[model samples]
Target: MPAYFQGLAIGLAYVAPIGMQNLFVINTALTQPRRRALLTALIVIFFDITLALFCFFGIGTVVERFALLQLLLLLCGGLIVTRIGVGLIQEEPTLDQSVEVDLPLKDVAMKACVVTWFNPQAILDGTFIFGGFRAGGVAAGESLQLILGSSSASFLWFFGITLVISLFRAHIGTKLLKAINTVCGAVLIYYGMGLFLDGVGRVQQMLSSLF
Candidate 1:
């Protein structure tokens, strides 16, 4: 496939992994109106793109290497991820609430950015997926191009979803919102467990090899 098409395929594959951050952004947009929700989505995109650049560079090496580092990250990060997933699953969606209390774009953006930056899967995707692709024979520009392409898919899905929600905001009640959260959270919990188990297995292997 051509580089552009390759980028598209890779991008879609890259963004397909579901997570809390995406769920929150989608939920926010659907619950809130244009300014606040779009700000949230844009914040997510900004963090994702910035992290992609960071991982593309040599910065991720420190984390990618060393079994101990992986363990550290998994133990701390995985727990956090699992917690967020559980939180989402437990949340009672309040879809009936009026879309009031306008949040400033800057503040909303900053919070969304922080939330996106801290999301462990964001790191994994940026570091593992994007980083791996770039490390391959692909040109640097092309690698970034691929990442941007992938990011676009995320942007499109998120914004597209928000657009639909905004259009039908009146109809989607708490039950539907709760169902969405439950599904997203269940998926996230599965991913978090996988991360935890993978790290545990690596540690076990490292120990076995020591003897």
Candidate 2:
């Protein structure tokens, strides 16, 4: 019970952060139709569980142990996220009150996977946050409980956000959509730049320690 509650709280705390993933989900919900957005949310949930499971099972330790790999992930992820952010700024959502533009199912799935899996922060969350909790053993069957609690948090948050956006979508005009794009883009770019800088700093620190 304690393990389950602990996992739930930690999971919520991680998802609550205004990071690239949350913003992407919200933006998708606002711009895309309910069906497509729901699909995207499911995909996001899948990746979240996959990552958490990987970390909880101890595979994430292998990846996180190498500082060089972490640095590389940060660099690559940062560049991709920043590029995406810039592109989002230029692309307008072609949605109106009566009309809904639904992205192809495959396209939505691919985007959801990329945005959820490739972010460096997401990697850190799995490796550091979930991995740390996983190290603290739960009761025999409690491991499953913890995983359920964490998975539930992901499902609830994504679906909840999607539902809210879907309900209010008609009231949300195009201008507001554009504004969301702009803000989300800027925030993603900032996160990317920060990731890049953090990688550079980590490398520098490693070098200094060696010298």
Candidate 3:
């Protein structure tokens, strides 16, 4: 029981920050229909939970042990994230409520996956945090309970935010939405550039070591 609560708290702390996942969800809620927004939230939750599981189970160790893997992830994730940001910046927000601007379900899922799985920061952070907990004398049953609690947090936070945004979307003007998108897009591009630079530095170090 204590473990479960601990996991719940950690999970909220892990996810409550303004990041790619939250930005994507918020944008969907603002632009898409209520059903589509909720579905996007669900897709994000699925990816988040699976990512948590992967980190808790030992993927973190694998990433740590393999410099090549880390380099590839950084480079690929940066490119993809940067492209997504460019798209958001270019997108023109509409005031028309009658027009369906909803993306296809597959597109939603793909974006969710990229924002969750391709995020090296999220992966590395989750790996350290959850992996640390797993290494810290937790019993198997307790670990399971902890994971369940974390999953619950993802469910609660995404759905709650989506519903709230959907309700207030009427009050949100197109200008405000466009501003939000621009800001979020800039942030993402900055983050992506950092990742790409880090990847480049890693490559340089590897080459130096071999020489």
Best by lDDT: 3
The clash count of every prediction, one per candidate, is 0, 0, 0
lDDT for residue 2 in candidate 2, whole number 0-100: 77
RMSD of 2: 1.9
User: Please, what are the lDDT tens digits per residue for candidate 2 over residues 1-211?
Assistant: 4777777877787787877778878888888778878888888888888878887888678886777788898888988888888988988875664776767778877777778788888878877788887676556678888888888888888899999988888887789889989988998888888888888888889899999
The count of residue-pair clashes in candidate 3 stands at 0
Model 1: per-residue lDDT, tens digit, 64-175? Answer: 7765766776766676667667987897766555538477777777656645665666776667876787778787567656766766776776677667667777787778
Tell me the TM-score of each prediction against the true structure. 0.77, 0.91, 0.95
Candidate 3 lDDT tens digits, 42-81: 9999999999999999998899899899999899888878
Instruction: State model 2's lDDT.
Output: 0.82
The positional error of residue 140 in candidate 2, measured at the CA in angstroms, is 3.1
Which residue runs of candidate 3 sit more than 4 Å off their true CA positions? none
Worst lDDT run of 10 residues, candidate 2, spans 94-103
lDDT of 3 at 207: 92
| Clash list (residue pairs), candidate 3 | none
Provide the lDDT at 22 for model 1. 63
